[model samples]
Target: MWTINRFPGLWLLPALLPVILMTVYPIGHALWTSLHEVMILFPGEPFVGLRNYGRVVASNYFQDALRNSLVFTLFAAPSVVILGTLIALFLQRRFFGSHVVRSIVLLPWVLPGAISAVLWVWVFHPSFGILNGIMRDLGLIEDSILWLTNPRTALMAVTFAHVWTQIPFAVVLMMAALSTINSETLEAAAIDCRNPLKRFRYIIFPEIKAMIVVLLVYNALIAFTSYDLVYAMTGGGPGTATTLLSFQIWRESFSMYDFGAGSAVAFIVVVISAALIVAITRALPSDLFAGD
Candidate 1:
C-alpha cells in the first residue's frame, strides 16, 4: 500500500519545482550574496566574507531592531486572532446588511499593503492632519499629536494601522473555517439549553482550534516581516524605536550599502518565520483537512 509507485510522494516534490524556483532561488542567491560584500549602486565596491554578518551581530542597532520586531509580532498576532474571531462570529449570524458589511471590511485587505501604509502616513501627519482634526472636533485633543515622529507612540500608531488592515483578512479566513462546522450541531447546541457563551466555548471553539493556530502563525509571520508600514511612516526614525528587522535589512542594504549584512538579517527573519510556522503546525491536532 505504501509503495513508491502507489504513493507518488517522490514525484510530488518535483511537481513543486516551479514554486521552489520562485521562492527558493532568491533565498539561495541571497545566502550566497550574504557571504560576499559588494556594492553596485555606490562609488566604491569590494568583496568581503562573513564580516558583514559579524558586524550586524555585534551592532546594538540590529539587536534593537530584532527586539522591536518580536514585540510587534507578539502584540499584533494575538490581536488579529481574537478580534478577528469576534468580527467573524458576529458576521456569521443572519443580520441586515451583514454581507455588505463583510464586503466593506475586506476592502482594506484588497488594497496593496504599501498603499495602505502610505495612506496612513498622511493620516498621521501632525499639524493640520485629518487624525488630529478629528480629535479636535470630537474634543479628544487640543493639539495635533505627531504619531510617526514620536518614539513612544510610533510603534503603537503603526500597529494600529497594521491591525486595521489585517483584521479583514483574518475575518475572512476565520469565517471560512467557521463555515465548516456542522450547522446541525450548532442548531442542536441552541436546542440543548447552553447559553450563547457556553455554546461557543464548548462547541464552536474546539472545532476551530487547528485553524486558529494556523491563522495565528500566519499573522505572526506577517507582523514579523513588516516593512512597508514602518518604511512609509517612520523610516525607522525617532531613534530607531519603531524599526523592525525587515526595515533594518533594507537600510543596511540600500542606505548603508551593506548587502552582506542585509542578507544575513533576511536569512534570520526567514528562519524565524519558518520555525514559527512549523511550531504552530505541530501544535495543531492531526485531523486538520482530514475527515473524522
Candidate 2:
C-alpha cells in the first residue's frame, strides 16, 4: 500500500492545475506581451524588449499615479485597522441593541464599492449635501468644502471612502479573533491586573496582535489596488490628482490603447504587491504561526 506522502505531487496536481491555468498562464502572457510594441501607432506589434517598461517608468503621469496610490494606502490602511478594531471591541460586548449595531456596521462593506462611492459623493457634495448642511447648521463654516474636486482634499476624500468600506471587514475578522480568547484566561488576568489598560496590555493585546497585523496587510493591499471607488467618485480627476496605479493601468491600456506599456505597469504593481505581502508575512512574530 502506497502512503499519501509517496504521491504528494501527483495528489496536488489536480488542485494546482486550475491555479496555474488561471493565474500563472495569464501572468506569463502579460509578461510576453509587455516585451513588444502593441499600440496602434506601431504596426505588427514589433519586439521592443524593455522599452515599454522604460516608457512607463519615465512617464510623469505614472509617477503621479504611484504617489497617489502610496498616499491612499498610507491613510486608508491604518484607518481601517484602527477604526475596525475599536468598533469590534465595542460591538463584541453583550449590550442592548448590540445585534442591531453590528448589522448597521456591515452596511457600508456590504454595499458594492461603486455604490459606496456614489453614496459618499452625495454626502460630500458641495451644495445641499448632508455633511455640509449639518456643518452649516452647527455654525462650523460659512463655505462648503470641495471634498472630491480640489486636489488638496481629493485623495484624502477617497481614502475616507475606502476606509469606510474596509472597517466592517476588519471588524468581522477581529471579532472572530476576539471570540477565540479563553474566558478563564481573561478572568485570571483581570484578577491580577486591576487596571483595565494593564489587563488589556497583558491579556487582550497579545491575543489580538496577529489579527491586527493581518488586517493591516489586507487593507493595505486593497487600498493599493482600489479602482472602482476612485472611478465612481473622483474619476481620478482634478487633473490626475487621484489617478492611482490601477486607474493608470486602465487609462493606459483601454483609454490610450497602450497595451504593452500598461502590462509593464501592471507587472510592476504585481511585483510591489507581492513584495509587500512577503514583508508583512515575515514581520509576523515567529510564535504566532507555531501551532500551524
lDDT, candidates in the order shown? 0.86, 0.89
Please, what is the TM-score per model? 0.87, 0.92
Provide the lDDT at 271 for model 1.
83
Give the residue spans of candidate 1 off by over 4 A: 1-10, 41-49, 137-140, 278-292
Instruction: For each of the candidates, give the backbone clash count.
Output: 0, 0
Model 1's TM-score against the true structure: 0.87
lDDT of 1 by residue, 1-292 (tens): 4677787877788868887899989999888777777566654435667787788879999889988998999899989999999999999999899889989989998988789988898888898568998999999998789898888889998888888888998998899989999999999999995698999888998888777887798899999999887887788878989989999889888888878788988987888888878876786668764653
Steric clash pairs (candidate 1): none
Report how far residue 35 has shifted in candidate 1, in Å.
1.7
Candidate 2 residue-wise lDDT at 267: 89
Q: Tell me the TM-score of model 2.
A: 0.92
Give the least accurate 10-residue stretch of model 1, judged by summed lDDT. 38-47
